[model samples]
Target: MPTILLIEDEAALGMIVKDSLEMRGFTVQYAEDGEEGLRLFRAALPDIVVADVMMPRLDGFSLAERIRAENQTVPIIFLTARSQTADVVRGFELGGNDYLKKPFSMDELIVRIKALLGRQPAAPEAPAGPLPIGRYRFDYPKQRLHLDSHAADLSNREAELLKRLYDQRNQVLERTVVLRELWGDDSFFNGRSLDVFITRLRRHVKDDPQVQIINIRGIGYKLVV
Candidate 1:
């Protein structure tokens, strides 16, 4: 049976969801606020997280961001009352795997949960890296950016981009292709956001003498091995 973490502040709704999941043979852990949810998450590391968007101490967006920083493959489902475009966009940007709007049916939630769990393959072993790139070394699965012996934590997007670049080392990755695949969008704002992330990557690898991320003018970026 899969374990699930349910983060919802409403007593009635929380109990209903928790009970429903439990009845379905899933082991469920409940948290009434974002802070406690995060604490519980770190301690237990459940198979999936179902979090409410609006909560005290910390919000769903921030919680999801934090989780993604640690485990990129963990599936997160956001429960939000607001269905605005910006809210949806932000959810995906924060690495949400699924979103459930307010007043959603319990059965629908269960179906979604099952689908997400099914999609996840067994966790892959951490790849050996910190493979010297220029002045920095990236420990891929560890998501650490290191200059010699010192290490820096990378944001989720940063880690994903770095991994992609390294995976296709020396290849020119198209800008549109990267944005659409990683970010789920290729709008002007998203394109600009990609540039910002690229700049950050450059900063991290600036110490490396051999590894360089070069912008190919009108085309894409070349991750020079």
Candidate 2:
């Protein structure tokens, strides 16, 4: 059985998630606030985490940032009621492995947790190479990207996206394919969410004129250099 740290302030929802996960053969430790959640998270270092965005003592984003600073590989799933684009983007920026908006079904949460844990094997160490995008260089082994003598910190999702695009350079990456590969599903909502990340990447590489993210009509995006 896998272990899960569930950080949720709502007593009813926390209990429901706890019971549901335990019934599925998982050992769950519940935390009602961010501080205790972080303490338990470090002590137990569970296989996965399910956290709510809003909490007393500390918000989900701060807790997640702290965890990511220490453990970059642990899986995290964020729970939030707000559907705003900024909220979603911030969650991903803070190293959330996945996101489930509020009012989500229990079944969906279970499926997401299973999918994340199942994909662990596929996320092998990134290949060793100097990934060149225009004048910028991405050293995958070192997890560093250099641009004009300056280094930029690429988040996990950013690194993943960059790797995929670089792997399929000069090729048309179907929107659905990228979504399923990166986000697990290609729902319209997720599509829009993906667009936000794409936008952020565009901003990150704005200095490189040769780096282009072309949007194909009703199709997908192509990263051309």
Candidate 3:
């Protein structure tokens, strides 16, 4: 079973989350703050880490940064309040894999966790410049897309989404398949997020009318080149 290290200061919420995750077959190590959480992280070396951003001693951003300094591939997810969009962005900037705003459902959290775990380990980097999309050049390692002389940087998740579609270019990729493979669940929220990402991607390639990520309503998406 995969081990998950959960760090949250709220006593009741902590227990509830831990119990919910355990019931879902994950081995969890609970901590009340970031200092102790970091210690446990070093000791247990869990497969994944779920932490709250407002903990005492070591905050979630710092904890995740520290963890990344030691291990780059171990997925880390942040839990924070809705207003802390800056913190959420910083958490991802610090190498966290995902984040859940406060007041989120346990089911949502579970599916996000499952989705991150389901990601295939990144493969060895390829030699040369960047992978070519219809009229754009996508540099996967750098998370950049170039159109003519202009370049747009994408978030890690966005880059991953683009890579998946590029790999299956000209194919109709099911919505659920993409959701399960990239977001862990095919829930409404994630589906909406997928829509946002799709829109962002569409804008990125809009300079070239030849490239399109078409939405096949009630079905999925098709990357047309």
Please report the candidate that would top TM-score against the real structure.
2
Per-residue lDDT of model 1, residues 107-212, tens digit only: 7788667755643232233575466666677776666888766988775457767777776789888888777655545766457657767877887777765778
Error of 2 at 102 (Å): 2.1
Query: How do all models score by TM-score?
Result: 0.57, 0.73, 0.61
lDDT of 3 by residue, 159-220 (tens): 77888888778998898987777776687655766776787788889988889999889998
Cand. 1 Cα-lDDT: 0.79
Between which residue pairs do clashes occur in model 1? Answer: 130-138, 134-208, 134-209, 134-210, 134-211, 135-207, 135-208, 135-209
**Tens digit of per-residue lDDT, candidate 2, span 39-112:** 99989989888999999998899999998888775778899998887788778766776889899888888877
Model 3 score (lDDT): 0.81
Task: Give the total clashing residue pairs for model 3.
Answer: 1
Q: Candidate 2: minimum summed lDDT over ten consecutive residues — where?
A: 116-125
Model 2 residue runs over 4 Å out of place are 118-163, 199-218
RMSD of each: 5.7, 3.9, 7.0
lDDT of every predicted structure (CA atoms): 0.79, 0.81, 0.81
What would the C-alpha RMSD of candidate 2 be, to one decimal place?
A: 3.9
